[model samples]
Target: MRFTFMCKKDMVPIAGPHGRGKIAIVGAGPAGLAASGYLVCQGYEVDVYDKLPLPGGLMSFAIPSFRISINSIIEGVEDLRDNFSVKFILNTKVFKRDTVRRDEGDEFTKNTVDLRELLNNYDAILIATGTWKSRKMNIPGEDSKGVYTALEYLFLLKSYELGYLNHEPPKANKVIVVGGGLSAIDAAEVMIHRGADEVYLVYRRTINEAPAGSFEINRLRRLGVKWMELAAPKRIIADATGNVKEVELIKMKLGEPDESGRPRPIPIEGSEFTIEADMVIEAVGEIATSPFPDQEYLGIKQDRRGRIIVNDELRTGNEKVFAAGDVVSGPSKVGRAIFLGLNAARNIHLYLTTKRISKGGT
Candidate 1:
């Protein structure tokens, strides 16, 4: 649980005026931070930009601090800053045009820097901007006042906990979390922590197929959380004031495997149920958010799912641009993001040293 960046004690620092070409990292999350560590050790002038005021990304803002030590993340970041001379541009969003979608960490963004600006200035640009947009259920009354995405709810609470917000997030007595992912588990735990009397976790699939796995679900069950599998929320029932009062759910049965190779949950007709809920937290999933909109900006192509297209070297269509982490691989665990980041950094180092763009970068 002791999370810290790799030490660069023996490695010579190559920063300052005579260092290698500057590298601009678009995110300060695990991937971006990992790449910054490697690039800095290699003597590249590294600058990281993020929308959040802090430098730890989801580790510092969205994910629970207990799960990831905030002090450890901050310490590693401070080491990069003080020893490696890595520059962090906080509270700034790097995007192209006004088409960038508003995500969880945008609250503290006081300034915006064009993506083209970085492309023009830095020798290489690494886009590690992790997924920030939460996927919606698109059900009726989802826009209700008491309904919130897991990312938004967690971010709001974390901002308050970190003193970025003066007030606390609204509390609920009975909360219902939808989905079977880690986000959903975290949301259910947060509700318990927030003193919710009743916490229900309803998922379309069983715990065996949950993204968070069965152990976590069972652990939450031991903590008094009611786990209801084979159920999907049909809609959020709102009161006259537009506040969430209940959730209508439909029973489901697993059928043939879907595109994800997971058994698709087939809704059973006429098998509906309702759960009283003062608040609803949707943790279905998250969408990868690129700095640019849904277009091939600067020759950087994104899939229909909004994930950036990269070659074997993590190089995008633009020779000078590379991508890694959730932005390129979709939503993933911190370890996976870190691995991709280090890989991208190594490839970038090779490209910079050889002065030859890798073949098939597009």
Candidate 2:
């Protein structure tokens, strides 16, 4: 299916007077882009800043174009820039403080902007910096050369495919992806498309309990992607050159429901097995990433898991700042993030018009 943002009837002509106020949105992902569309239509001067070279963020970078057409995103972004006067500051990362913290999609960042500077310059600020850091299994030999996070692997190939990188991404003959999420499915499909002779999708839970659902998993299986259910990686065995050679996996069984309301996988004794692999991708999950290192910065607080804390109105502790999307609710689909972005945009318009903001840090 095609994803068109500006083609929709909601892409209203610029309404209200210009110079309503300057709004700075960090991260040009789904939420940030959606908010920009809304605020720009409302006649606010919107500037979207992202570390990537393109404006669509993950939609244009990490995610494969087959799933989300980059051309559609580019068309929408072009509409915002040409018609509504939205400015996208690409290849620049917004940071609260100068630190060495970097995420998967930050490889192409050429410049940096301080959060404090944006707060002082812009009339309003929105932080929609979605999840960027990939979760690791923390198993032995995980730091091997051939072991990569799903984002890193996908982003590298995507960067090359988009002509941002000159070098080609490495091709693996035998690949193993660990997870049951969409990322895993995407990774498996990519490997298969890249001519990998063997691709395996290993998940800790059964196909029925997978986060990506059985339909996607079964689809991958039919595409010659081996499905290893009720199994989890215990260790990544490396060759003498420190590259991944094989992965030691342990069988698992479903136990009582855990905090996620899904049956937790319990390790089965004496069920360890080793699978040969040229490359291993960890697609377990991702964590919310903000521009700051501190838990609380400028009255914006993040939860223990790194999700930005917000209230019913989607306002941050600072009256002039708001947040939305995966950064606030953790990893979510594009549709959910878009909905949250539009909702936050409405709240922002309400705040800007009335000069009264909701009190929230929850």
Best by lDDT: 1
Candidate 1 similarity to native, TM-score: 0.96
Tell me the number of clashing residue pairs for each predicted model. 1, 0
lDDT (CA) per prediction: 0.88, 0.87
Model 2, span 160-179: residue lDDT tens: 99999999778899999999
- How much is the lDDT of residue 17 in candidate 2? 35
Question: In model 2, which range of ten residues has the least summed lDDT?
Answer: 1-10
Q: Model 1, 2: alpha-carbon shift in Å? A: 9.3
> Which residue pairs clash within candidate 2?
none
lDDT of 1 by residue, 112-228 (tens): 998899988999999999999999999998999889899999999988999999998899999999989988998899999889999999999898899999899999999999999
